[model samples]
Target: MRRTHSLRTRLAFGYGLFFAAVLVLMSAGVYWLVRQALLTEVSQELAAAAELIQQDFAASAGPLPGFFSDPDVLLKSLPPRLTELDTPAFYVQVSDLDDQFSIGSASLRGQQLPRTPEDQTAAMGGSTTTRIFPLGRGRVIQLSAPLLAGGAVVGVLQVAQSLRPVDQTLQVLLEGLAITGLIALVAAVRGGVWIVSRSLGPVNEITSTARQIFQAADLARRVPAASAADEIGALADTINAMLERLESLFTAQRRFVADVSHELRTPLTAMRGHLELLQRGVVRDAEDQAEMTADLLREVNRLTRMANDLLLLAQAEVGLQLRCAPVALDDLVLEVVRELRPLGEGVAMRPQLAEQVAISGDRDRIKQALINLVANAIQHSPVDGTVTVALDQDGESAYLRVRDEGQGIAPEDLSHVFERFYRADRARAQRTGGAGLGLAIVQWVAHAHGGEVLVESALGSGAAFIIRLPLSREQETEDRG
Candidate 1:
C-alpha cells in the first residue's frame, strides 16, 4: 500500500511543534519577569511622586474643592513646567481638590484624569492610593496622597506619569524575541528535515529493489546492500538473504525438470521401440509376446522406482521428517545387508558387524538409503568379485563401508556422482535399469544424519563407498548442542 507521508514534512512539523510549545512557555516566563521588574520600578516612582505632592499640599493647607476633590489647588502649587524636575524625561502631571496641571506633557493639553470620593477618602485618611488614567491614545499611572489640616482631611495630593518608558521597553523586548524565535525555529526545522531524509533514504532503495522482482513468476532480482553499520544495513542484509534463498530454489527446480526429462527419455524410447516391434507381428509367438510385455512392464517399474527415489531425496533435502529415538546402528546395518543378500548373488559376500552402535535416526529411511547403496555395489561388481560390508564405531561416530571390486568411477564423474539422474556410463545404466537416484538418496541420507558419504576410487581400482553416522544419542546431542 502506498502512503502519503513525506519524511521532510513530518520531521519539520515535529520539531516545529515541540520547540514552538517550549518557546511559548519560555516567552511567557520572560514576559512575567519583565512585567514584575517594570511594575516594581513604577511603584517606586509613584511613591516618590506621591511624597513630593504631599509636601506641596502640606505647605499650602488648602481646603479640598469638592467632597471628592477636583485636584484644582493641587495643580496650582505644582510648577508650571517640569523642565527643572528631577525626571524631566517623564511627563509629570498633577491634580488635587483645587485644580489640575500638566507640567511636562507636550501631548496632554486637556486630559481628564481618574478621581473618586472613595479614592479621595482613602488618600486623606492616613493612606495613599493609585489608579490608571486612560488618555485618548496613551495611558498613565497616578498616585494620590492626603494633605493634613490639623489631623483631619484637607485635600488630596495627586501625582501622575505617562506610561511611555515601560511601553517602549516592552516593545523592544517583543521585537527581539520574535526575531530570535523565528531564526531558531528555522534552524531546528532545517536540521530535522535533513536528518530524516538521510535516514529514510535506505527505505526508498528497498522499495525500488522489491519492485524489480517479478510477480508469480521466475525469480531474478537482487537487493543492493547499503554500506552502513546501522539498522538499515541490517534490514538490507535480511532482504539479501531471502533473495538468495529464492534464487537457489528456482535454480534447483529448473535443474530438476531438465534432469528428470533427460533421464526418462531413454527408457521411454526403449519401451516404445519394443511395443512397436511387437505390434508389427514380429512377436507372433506367445513367448515372444510375453517377453515384449515384460520389457514394457520393466520400464514402467523402473520409472516408478526412479520417481519414488527422487521424491524421497527431495523430501530429505527439504527436511520434511520429524526426528525419533536412538537407532541401534549395528543391528540396522546387519539387517540391511541380510535384506540385500539376494541381490549380491554371483558375487562373494563378506560382512564385518559392530556391536552396541546407536545413533538418533529414522530407521526405515536409513534402511532404504543403505539398500540402494549395497544394491548399486553388487550390481556393478564382476562375477565372483568380493562385496564386503563392514561396520565400525568410534567414540564420536559410526561408519559403514561397502566395498566392491568393480570398474571405478571416472575422476570427472566422481564429483557429480550423487547428483540426481547423473550416470557414469550410459551402457551400464541400460543393463542395470538404473535412473541414477540411488546415490543421490544416499547423499541425502548422510546429510540428514549430519554426516556425509565419501566415495574412494581410482580409474581401474575397485570402489569403496563410506557412510558416516553419529555414534550415539548422547554424541548426537552433544554435537547439536
Candidate 2:
C-alpha cells in the first residue's frame, strides 16, 4: 500500500497551507479596511451633499412662497441646482414625506428608488443615516436626511453615489493582493521544500549508502560523514561508527576462523597420518605400534587442549560465566606459587605474600589466572633466576604481581602478548610447547572480574604482569561488623 505522503510533500503542503491561511486573513483584513474607508468617505460626502441641497432649496424657494407647505415647490426647485452641483461620482434626490413625489439626478429621472425602511425612518424624525442597496447594474450608498421647515420635517433628502469606481478599485486591490499572496505562497512552498530537502540530504545519503552496502554485502562500506553540527550529521556519524565496528568484527571473525582451521588441521593431519599408517600395517614391530599410539594420543591431547582454550576464549568474548565469591588474593597467589614451584626446574619460585589481601571474584578463575601468569613466568625465566609471586593491596584495590627474570618481551611484541596464539618468539614457543593463550586467558579472567592485567617489561630486564582487582567490600564490612 502507498501508506503515507513523502516527507518533502508533507512539509511543503503543511508550510504552503499555513502561508496561504495567513495571506488569506491578511488580504481579508486589507479588503475590509479599504471597503470601510471608501464607504465611510462616500457616506460623509453624501451627508455634505444632502446638507447643501437643503440649503439650496431653503434659500432659492423657501422665501418666495409656499415651498414649505407645498411639496411640488421644493421638488421642482431642487433638481436643477442639485443637477448643476452633481458630479459623475455622486447624485442627489428629493422626496416628499408621503414618498410619492421624487426627483433626482438625470439617471434617476425615469427611475424611482423605493421607499426603503431607512428612508421611512429618517422621515419619522430619526437621525441622518446611511444604507447600501443595489441600483441599476451597480451598487450605491444611500444617505437619508430630513428636509425641515419651521421646526418640522416636510420632506426627505437622499444623496446616493454609485459604488462602481470604488468597487473597481477594491477589486483591483483584491486581485493584486491575491496575486501577491499566491506568489508568496509559491515562494514559501518552494523555499520550504528546498530547505527541507537540503536538511534531509545527509539522511538520504546515509540511506542510499546503506542500501548499496546491503546489496553488496560489504561491511567495510560507510556513509560519508558530515561536518554540520545537526541531528543529520550525528546520524551519519553514528552509522559510520556502526559500520566501522561491524567491519572490524567481521574481519576479526574471518581471521579467527582461518587461524582456528590452520591450528586444528595440524593435529588432525598428524592423527590421520598415524591412523592411516596403522590401517596400512606400516608399523614394523610392537614397539613401533606403541610409539605410534603414543604419538596419536599426544596429538589428541593437543587438539583437545586447543579446543578447550578456544571455547574459553569464545565464552570470554561474549561475557564469561564466572561463579563469584570472596577470594583471598594472598592465599591464591601463594597457592599458585606452590603449584608452579616444583615445575620451575632450574628457575627459583619466590613469594612476596602480603597479609589480609582479599577481593570479590570467582576464586577458581582467579586461581587459574594466577597459575597461568606464574607458569608463563616459569617458562620465561632463566636458569637459577627467580620468578616472584607477590600479593598486596592499596586503599581500594588488591594486586597480584608476577615478575620473571628472563629476556623480557621485545617492545614490538609487548603489546600483543595477550592476543590469542601470539608468541613473542617462535623458537621459544616450540621449545616450551606453550600455546601462547596463557596470558590471553589471564587477561580474560582479570577483565571478567572487573579488573585488568597490566604488563611492564624491557628487553633482557625481565617482565612483570600485575593483576589488579577491586578490594572486597564484604571483607571490610565483615571486619567492621
Candidate 3:
C-alpha cells in the first residue's frame, strides 16, 4: 500500500515487518523484568539490614549512639553491596523515631531524608519509590523505612539511590532497538521493491510489444509466448488468440469489400459509358441504338440484383424474423421445381416426396432455399440429367435432399462449396453466369430456421445436399410467438 508493490513482494515484506514487530514487543516486555529485578534486590538488602538492627536491639536494649559504638557491629548491621548490583547503587540511613541521627551509608553522605508526609507515613518495615531526593548533581530513587519494636515502628530509616545505572542501560537498549528496527524496515522496503520490479518485467514487455505492432499495414502482429505457465503467460496466450481471430475477420472483410466494389463498379461503369455514347449520338442507326440500349438495360438489371442481394445479406446478418405456418414439404419442393423448369435442359425433376409431410417454417424463406437449391442443381446438370427432389422425415427433423446427376465438385474445392464467390473452376463461369452466393444464401436461410445444409458427394459422382429442419407444431408456435 505504501508504494508500487506486486502481490509477491507485499506478502514477503509484510511478514518480515510483522516478525520484527513481534521481536520488539518481546524486548519491551523484558524491560519490565529489569524493573522488577532492580526492586527485588533493593528490597532484599533493606530487609537484611532491618533484621540485623533488630537483632542487635534484642541483644542489648540500650538506645544507640552508644549501642553501635563498635564499628564492626555497626558495619554488619548496615546493608552490604553485592557484585550483581554492579556498583554501590543504593543509599542507607539510620535514625531514631524522634528524628535523632544514628548512622548512615557512604552513598547517602551528602543527602538528607525527607521530613514530609511521605517520610513520616511509617511502613511495617520498609517502603520505596522512584521519587527524587535532590542531591548535588541529579536525582535518586528514595527508599525510606520504619524500624519495628515488637509490633510497632520504633524508628525511621531512609535511603536514596542514584537512578543513573538503570537509566543508562535503558537508554542503550532503546538506542539498540531503534537501530535494529530501522535496519529491518529498510530491508523490507528494498526487498519489496525488488520483487515488484521482477514480477512486472513480463507485463512491461507485453505493453511495449503491443505498442510497436503495425497491424494496419500488415494484418499479423502477435505476442511472443513465454515459457512460464503463469497468469502473465496465460494473458499473452489469450491476447495472441484474440489477435488471430481479429486478423482473420479483418482479412475476410477487406477481400469482401474489394470484391463487392469491383462487381458493382463493372456494371455501373458499363451503364454510364453506354448512356453517354448514346446521348452524344455515337450510335446513329436504329439497330446500333437498340443493341446499346439492350446492353445498358442488362447492366442496370444486374446492378439492381447485386444491390438487392447485398441488402438481403445485411438483413440476414441482423437475424431477420421467419414467419411460422404449416407448409407441406412436398408441395413446396414441387413449386420450386416448377418455377426453374424452363431455365436449364428442361432438367426433368424426379420427385420422391413423402406425401403432405408438414414442416414448420416461414413459407417465403423456405421456398427461397428450395428454389436456390433446385436452380443450382439444374444449372450444373448435363443435358437430360435427372434432378431428384426427395423429402422425408428423419427423427424429429424434416429432410429435403436435392440430388442431381452432374459432374461432382472436386475434392479440393468440396469443403468451400457453400462459400460466397467460391467457384470450383473459374473458367466455367461463362456457362453458368452465377454470382456464387446462391448456395450461401440457401445455407443462411436454413440456419435461420434452426437447420443446416449438408452436402455429400465424390468427384465425378452426383452431389446431394440434405436440408434437415425441425418439423413440429410447437416449434412453429414458438417461432411465431
Candidate 4:
C-alpha cells in the first residue's frame, strides 16, 4: 500500500529537500575549490624543488669538466632530500639518454622509473615536464628536467613526491563536508517542519472548527480570524463569511418550513371542519348548503393559490426559464392594471404610459410581476386611495413605477420584503394578499430580465415600487417581426 502524506508533511519535506540540495551543491563547490587549492600548492612545491636541484647540479659541476657529461658523477652529486626538512616522502632518479636508470631514492632504488614521451622530449629540448599518476597505495607527482652539458642534453633528472599528505587533507575535508551537510539537512528538516506547522496553525483551527460545525450541524460556528494579514487570515475570514451565509440560509429555511406548515394547516383545518359538518348533516337547507360549499371552495382556492406560489418560488429559486420576446412596456403595464382593477375595489388606479416604450423579456412573467405589485398596492391602499402605474424611459432604460396612497412599509421590513414567505404584517397580508411570495416573485422576475425592483416607503406615508429595465436594441425588428 502507498502512503499519502498530509499537506504539512509535504510542505516541510519539499522545503527541506530544496534546502538540502542547495547545501549539497555548496559543499561540493567548496570541496572542489579546496581540492584545487591543495593541488596547486603541491605543484608549486614541486616546481621549487625542481628549480633547487637544477641550481645545485649547475653549482657542483662548474669546477669539474661538465659533470652532467658523466651520469655516475651526476648521480653522486644529487641530494636525496630536495627540501630542508619536514617535507613529505620524496623520490629522485637519474636516467641516461638511453632510458637506463642510474640512481634513485632508497624506496625506489633498483626500480626503473616510468618513462614517457615527455621524458624524451624534455631530454632533447632541455625543458621540464611534470605528470601525476597512482603509485603504491597512494598517488605521486613527478617532475622531469634535462641535464645539460655545454648546451647538449646528457641525461634526465626526475623528482617525485608522495601525495599521501594531500590525500589525507582532502579526505578529512570530505568527511567534514559530509558530517556538516548531514547536520544542516537535519536542522533544515526540523526547522522547516516547525515553521510550516506554525504557519498552518490557523488552517488547522479552521479544519477543527469545520469538523465541529459538521458534527453538531450548527451553521453558526465560525473560525476565529488569524491575527496576521496573510493567506491564512484570508482563509479564516472567508470561512467565517461563508458560515454567516450558511447560518442565514439555515434560519430562513427553518422559518419557511414553519410558515408553510402553519399556512397549509389553517386551510386544511377549515376544510376538515366544514367536511365534518357536512358529513354530520349540519346543513339543513339549500341556502345553507350553498353557503357551506362557497366557503369550502374559497379555502380550496387559497390552497391551490398557495401551491402555485410555492411552485413558482421553487422554480425561481432554481432559475426562472423566461420565454424571451420584445414586450411593449406601456401596453403591458396598462393591461395588468386593467386585470387588477376589480381587485382594487374602492381604490383608484391611474396609468402614466410613454409611447412605444419596449423591452426584451418574458411577457407573461413581466405581466405577473406587475400584477403582484399592483395587487399589493391595492391591498395596502385605503378606500378611495389612488394607485398610479407609470411607464417611462431614459436613454438606456425603461421604468415601471407603482405608487399607492397606503400605509407604507416599515423601515426594518423594507429590506426583507423580497424574501420568500416574509411579511411585515402577517395577519393583514394573509387576509388581503397571498402567502407572502408575491414580492419575491416580483424581485425574481426583475432580476431575470436583467432589471431591478426598488421601493421607497415610510410608515403612514405612501409607497412607490419602481421596476427598472434596460431598453432593447432590436425593438424595431421585434415590432416588424
Please name the candidate that would achieve the greatest TM-score relative to the true structure.
4
**TM-score versus the correct structure, for each prediction:** 0.59, 0.66, 0.59, 0.77
Question: For candidate 4, lDDT tens digit of each residue in 280-324?
Answer: 998778898888899899888988888898899898888868999
How well does candidate 2 score on lDDT at residue 397? 77
List clashing residue pairs in candidate 4. Answer: none
Candidate 2 lDDT over residue span 295-353, tens digit each: 88887777777778788888888876889877877777777777777899999888996
Better of 2 and 4 by TM-score: 4
Give the residue spans of candidate 2 off by over 4 A.
17-179, 278-291, 476-481
Write model 3 residue lDDT over 347-443, tens digit each, in one string: 7888787655677779888888888888888877888899999998754678899998888887888788887666776656534555667788888
Q: What TM-score does candidate 1 get on C-alpha atoms?
A: 0.59
Model 4, TM vs. native: 0.77
Please tell me which predicted candidate would have the highest lDDT against the true structure: 4
**Which ranges of candidate 1 are over 4 A from the true structure?**
1-3, 6-182, 215-221, 229-238, 313-319, 322-326, 379-385, 403-415, 424-427, 447-466, 471-481
RMSD of each: 8.9, 7.0, 9.1, 5.1
RMSD of 2: 7.0
Model 1 lDDT tens row, 1-481: 8888676687779888998888878877897799779867887887875666456545554454442343454445444333334353344444444444323244345444566787777865778777776655666776767755445655555556767777888889888888898888788778877887888888888877687665534356666788888888899888878888889877878888887887789789989899898878787899988988998998999999988887777677677674657787678777877788888778877778855567888787777778887888898899989888888866687898988899988899889899877889878887988888899888888888788899999877988999998776686565557
Ranking by lDDT: 4, 2, 1, 3
For model 1, the run of ten residues with the poorest summed lDDT: 99-108
For candidate 3, what is the lDDT? 0.71
Instruction: List the lowest-lDDT window of 10 residues for candidate 4.
Output: 79-88
- Model 3 CA deviation exceeding 4 Å by range: 1-192, 214-217, 269-294, 323-328, 355-360, 473-481
Q: Residue 10 in candidate 4 has what lDDT?
A: 97
